[model samples]
Target chain A: MKRGFNFSPGPGTLPLEVLEQAAEEMLDWCGTGMGVMEMSHRGKAFMSILNQAQDDLRELLMVPDNYKILFMQGGAVAENAIIPMNLLGYCAETPPIADYIVTGFWSDKSQKEARRYCNVNIAASSEGRHFTHLPRQEEWKLSQDPAYIHICTNETIHGVEYFWEPDLPGVGLPEVPLVADVSSHILSRPMDVSKFGVMYGGAQKNIGPSGMTFVIVREDLLDRALPICPSVFTWKTVAENNSMYNTPPTYAIYIAGLVFEWLKRNGGLKAMEKQNVAKAQLLYGYLDSSNFYCTFVEKDCRSRMNVPFFLHDDALNDKFFAGAESYGLLQLNGHSSVGGVRASIYNAMPLAGVQALVDYLRDFERIHG
Target chain B: MKRGFNFSPGPGTLPLEVLEQAAEEMLDWCGTGMGVMEMSHRGKAFMSILNQAQDDLRELLMVPDNYKILFMQGGAVAENAIIPMNLLGYCAETPPIADYIVTGFWSDKSQKEARRYCNVNIAASSEGRHFTHLPRQEEWKLSQDPAYIHICTNETIHGVEYFWEPDLPGVGLPEVPLVADVSSHILSRPMDVSKFGVMYGGAQKNIGPSGMTFVIVREDLLDRALPICPSVFTWKTVAENNSMYNTPPTYAIYIAGLVFEWLKRNGGLKAMEKQNVAKAQLLYGYLDSSNFYCTFVEKDCRSRMNVPFFLHDDALNDKFFAGAESYGLLQLNGHSSVGGVRASIYNAMPLAGVQALVDYLRDFERIHG
Candidate 1:
């Protein structure tokens, strides 16, 4: 079956081959006489699936031996609270302080949720600039001693991204761990795992499905969970059980494993990065060329995975979405908080899909202008 | 393709029809260009899927109007912690005491988990009896003005079940609410949702897949969450957001909705209960008449869903399992904690599957007796 381009931001488009492979294996996975969803998590069949997924992911990211990859549930939203619950124990002092750099909607939400458990210090925020750019590293206020520094590498809603990792040494706080929410752009580009203390994300964006969350954490960071932390969400507990502390979303993990395999077969993260850059450029270049369309994010910090843009005539918003949908483009409607169109071109979105979307954008501008 | 019988405790077997339907709609759902997994959680497509699932579940259980159906992530094991976090707020006293009736393995896990948030009282325990029976109501030591009472109506490991709800009046704790973890047997029989303050379970058994959990919470119980409760796990937030507090297990929920629809089409809970009784009786009756096999749980409390039995000759355990597999009976090996064979016949298991197992058992005994 022919499929159209999907731009839903999350639970986004998967590779056609991945979807076909999943459908073909829906009833019997590799002659196991059982669907992937039906196998016991502790059984050999599922254990292999989970092990291969974790191993492939580790290899793909070049994750260090000291880091444990945990497949957990509750997405990035729940991890906001879970992060504080797990990390507060590592603080040497009472009322442990954690620093957060708020870039856009996701980082802001992360800081707000963290307040429930500890002393959350917002050291820097791009909100003053309407979240159009990342806070400059030199300007960030570093806490004297913090349990961790938090950042959202890619803001899905505001279309802002950090191209460089925050260097704590530059800010005179070299010992603090840096935690990043890399949900929207995790697999879209290659990442240096050793530079960050922890990286986590929901699987819906560049990964596979909506229900699973992956937490890649350094070994030293695993033993610091607070007494109140739910065992299932505790990184230490999850890592000890090899992410099988609970069921670990058997089918979602299987699908994610399939996605990881697909990524490897297509030349790993380097290839994905190359194709992703091209897709983003095709759409952004066209938007920049037309006066009728504009992207708000700064050129230096624009997200390659999510492009939020606006039409010059606000009156044409409904017509723009309708026209795009008719041409087989989908979910271009921007987030409610951000009033514009957002074309989320993740790793799964091909160059041709972006070209089709760019063609529609140009056609729309010509007729509307 | 012909499929073999799968008896996995869970992440268990699903109806063949559900798997087929899912594959058929893998690319497009209900004429929507996007698959269920790809649709935005806030969009009309996924919302319709979520709403229909909740509505169908409510209809199947005859849940009262005051009960709110919440679709959340982090399966039953996570719900063990989430329940206390959400319910402890209803306590009138400091440190809020909750009573737990420990029937078997699952109930023991529940009480141990609840201790993280509240003071726990063991109101009744069948542990002294090796979890082979439910504690009689008259023997229960009721806690005065407790926050709530907890129970696991069906013990998946011990192969025990409560045929009747614990009448708070009979137990001399009439005002307190009852919370149940009905994970393995939720839809196998009709339930009185209004009788319990909350009913929750992971969806791997009877429902659909892993990663999704459903909570049927009473309306009046919504406002009592502690300040430390994670926003996503708090019942009030989940109910207010209509379970869209996070992305939710969209694909898991979709498949569960299909199971609910299948249940409704197959004469609903009444028919299911009747068939379940027949299946249990056939196996239990054969075991009682045969010297080769024996069940451990008390007859009155033996579960219709999970039937755990042992061979008379302990040496033949491995041979019995091998013989059963040759006849297409799978996952009959018992949980390691309970060393014997266990056949878990959830709602998805048809009468024919159980009959085939019974036939295999008789044939094996005839050959080896």
Candidate 2:
């Protein structure tokens, strides 16, 4: 059976080549006589896999030598708390204040979870505009001193993204450590890893699978974990132990390694970024031109990864989804929080897949209009 | 190439059939047009897979109706802290005291981790005997009102196991909640789920892979989580959300579901127990009679899952490991903490595998003796 184009927001589409390769190696990995999942995390075979994955990812992203790439668990949601537990020690305040730029659903969740561990200050919010655009950096209410500044670079549900990193000095805030939750669009484009104090995301979207979380933390930021932090989750412990403080999500890491290799083999992130931009333009361009379909997010801030749009007639929503699914487009239905259609054309999603969806969109409009 | 007898302790061997089935469905699952990993966790296809996995696991374990099963991340090492964060609220003392029966390596680790969250009391320890045996229950110094009594039912490293559940009355202890870390031996044999307050394990051993951690806790114990507990790791929150508090290790859960099905098709835990006993007996019986190799654990309390034995001449350790590997045996080397050889014959390991190892053992003894 032919595989469909999967637009799942997360645990989302993976390159067909990677999936085929993984399946081929399911029983035996590199002649190790054991499946990757069956090998001990401490064993030489798995260590090599882990090391190679880290190295390839570091090279692919041009990650700075001083930053440590940690393969973690619990996803970005868990990191909401883990981040404060690790970073709050830098603040001398009684209850360390964490400044957050809440752009959409994910950042909102991050701030709420952070409240459980530290004093959270919303430095800026795009919610007033329904998360359609980024709040200008200059408008943010910078705190006198914050343990760290956090932002979700790309909002998966809202389809809003930051085209450029926030320049703190230009925004009138003192130089501070910046943390970005790049879960949705991590590897889709080249990133300046050196600019951020830390960058992390779930592996499910552009990386590989759901279990492993990627944390790229600057080396100096690793030392200040709160006493309450779980030892395995402590950045200091994990980095010092080389993400082997515990048995990591080995299989997930292995898959992510395959993805990193696939990304490298296919012209790296630069090529991926070009394709992602074209796919986004094809969908957004169609929606912009067609009166029958509409996108809520502003054009300038539209995500290159997730494109959430709606049909003009609410009654056509179900019909639109059904028609798309029939054409081998799957999980195109939007998030329940934002009801419509969401096409997550991530790094693994090819131009042909987007063109297929675009073709279906035109065909559906002709029949229904 | 033929698959060798894999003896790596945790992240160990899996049923070949499960791996084959996973491979067949790698590109597309049940004509869903998307692979299991590519499907959204909230999507109907994945929801069905998740529910089926949970149901199959419930049936296989005969879990009590009052218990809630949580699929979490970070393996057993992470759960060491997560368990206390969720269970230590019952103690009203200045600093809650957790009673730990440290029989071997894992239990010692558990108690040490618990110290970071609460006061830990070593109620019983086999360290006096160099972890060669389980300390008799009668010899334990019970904590009058500890939050919970913790034990590692099967110590994967030291090859010690508790054959019988400790009856508090038999040991002059109170009827406090019992928490057992059954990482290496879970599902290898029949277990009375009603006997313990909680039974948790990392999936890498008998379940599926390294990413997912399973926690089977009685419903009454879910609400005692401390204020500091990360919401994602909290049992109450995880159970309320059906382990979807955060994006669960979806692929790992799917693989675990496949394993549960595999376990059922091969006869439930009862049949598995008989086979496990036979495998353990074959290996142990040989070591008991042989002058070249010896097992340290007391005969009455030996793990049916992990069998750590030693070459009488320590210098031959490398030779024994090399010989075993050459004979289609793999990972015969023991953990670094234990400087010998360990043959982890888990549920997925066939009797033939053990027989092959035994045959190799005999041949090696004849040549080296």
Candidate 3:
């Protein structure tokens, strides 16, 4: 009854080592008779766990001293509203203008939610191209004095990702801090923490589990939370309390800490990036070569993590999905809006899972084609 | 080394059976190649788990079909604000009157968050009494028509509880739906589901874990979410999606399901109540009879779940806690707001744990009193 590859964009797979370590310590954490889940967030055991996780994630991401990492909840979706509410607080004179670069589903969500809290400017979009490609930096429509330039570095749905970090240094958007919804690709590889003023993602995908989110923001931005922001969600309040302004997702943080340790043990982010590249290449190469399969995203922007593909013959979709499941390759079904197949190769996914999936893909095409 | 009894209000203790089952399922879930932690919420395996958990909880609680059970994140703190946002939609045409009865820290938190969205009336308050009892219903300043009358049925901090369901029939509040934040005492005993129009609890207490929240809302109130409410937190949206609109906390829900089954196997909520009563009685009896220890709450309103007590001689408090820790009774430190000791006896905390505390208390008093 072994489970198949879980291709959920998030609340997705976690490393077996991380889960194993957590299970072993479930009843008694660090000789403290109580598990991490049972401990008070203010207690020494949980404090140690929380601090270590924050520090390790910082070291791994090479976060600059000026940034504050917050462990909050409600995922990227809630942050859509929270980000604007907090970021646009400086719009004291009137509603602040925020610039958005629409890449796919997530950016669309961010843009819509931001509209609730500010006057949003769509500085750029790939919507004209049906979101199958990323618009280059040169194409973005600039807005003056926008509160922030928001982007979804990785769109989990459309499978289009930004492999190169945007350069805002000389661009008109330089003064406006870049805010990225990096939900699907935060820790898949190393990040330039200082490149963006704020980076946030739900933990379900690449971090650890579903109940927590990782937010890294420049320390100076902490004080600007709008008066309307919930105190618990306020960055200044959370930072001042060391991320314990409220009872955080203790177990999730513990598991995420275990993942950070595992990541360190398995070679740092560069090594992870290399492995991710290898995994993505193996799957994409097979799909591109097969006439029976078609990947919608352009070659250059294909995500190194989530890969959504469609069979040339859409009629065999269910049979394709059923066959894949029997082969122990699961959740290949694509998003409802785009009915086909999607394979999310998050960090927890091993190279073997991708090979198995690729192998299954080839075999399925051979028979179904 | 066994852990000490964790007495921190929430992110609290869980049933041993639940933790053990979770531990066993860490590597693989019922032969699925993945652990529950690794499964996508959309994956069939995790969905099956989710469905079963929802079904079992529905059965255990006998929740009406008209009521929707939502599994959400952000704990009770987030729900404090989210609740008013979603519920206020129905009250939008009106002046947005909502009644809140503040008993202790948690209720105070709920009231403060609700004020952000609605015209909250402090229907009753025990804060002036130093949180030693539930505010008498007769003294309540009832509004003729409120969007909802809110109550923190069980205060996690002051250890004061309403021994009986609030009777609002005499007041105009009868037609006004009763909304209760049952965060600390949701399933410790059988609850009259029909009494509350909405009941919500943070999972860290008696349910599963910290990151998850269990919300039960009557169906009619479901569709009234404000247009700006985040879909993930909207009761209507969650019920329609069966708690899977977003990637749910699959592992947490699975663990909660296991706890539900464990409760059923051990005689359901009725049996749980009996055990809790006996356990609380044992500890409170010792405290009542001892010259050196005292309980602040009135006997009629004292909680059978959380017992906050103190040494008559404050100087010996540290020695009392240290000695209790030596006996493996942990988390005895009281909340900082109240400088004393507190003991929480959730469903997962067996009578044995309480007995152990009583034994330790007697020994400590014998030497130090």
For candidate 3, the chain B TM-score comes to 0.96
Clashes of each: 0, 0, 13
The C-alpha stretches of model 2 lying farther than 4 A from their native spots are: A169-175, B169-175
* Candidate 1 structure quality by residue, lDDT tens digits, A1-369: 546789989989887788888899998888777889999999888999999999999999999999999999999999999999999887865789999999999999999999998888899998988999888888888677788999999999999998998887767766688999999999887898888989999999999989999999999988788999998999999999999888879988998998999999999999999998888888889999889988889999999999999997899999998888888899999999988899999988889999999889888878889
lDDT of 2 by residue, A1-369 (tens): 788988899989998999999999999888878899999999899999999999999999999999999999999999998999999877866788999999999999999999988888999998888999898877889788888899999999999998888776665545478999999999888988877999998999999999999999998888788989999999989998999988899999999999999999999989999988899989899988898888888878999999998888889998888888888999998889999899999998999999999999899989987
What's the candidate order when arranged by decreasing lDDT?
Answer: 2, 1, 3
Interface RMSD for every prediction, one decimal? 1.1, 0.8, 2.0
Top lDDT hit: 2
lDDT of each residue in B301-352, candidate 2, tens digit only: 9999999988889998877877777777998788889879999999999999
Better of 1 and 2 by lDDT: 2
Q: How far is A127's C-alpha from truth in model 1 (Å)? A: 0.5
Error of 1 at A246 (Å): 1.2
TM-score, ranked from best to worst: 1, 2, 3
The sequence of per-residue lDDT tens digits that candidate 3 reaches over residues B1-369 is 565666667778887777888888888788877787777677678889888888888888888888888999888888888788778777633768788898999889898888777788998898888988887778888776678888988888889887788776766455567888888887778788888889997888888778898899989888777765776788887888998777777677888889888988999888988998899889889999999899999999888878999898999988888888888888888889897999988888888888888888888888887
* Model 3 misplaced stretches (Cα beyond 4 Å): A1-5, B1-5, B92-95
The residue-by-residue lDDT of candidate 3 on A178-224, one tens digit each, is 89999899888988878899999888888888878888999878767
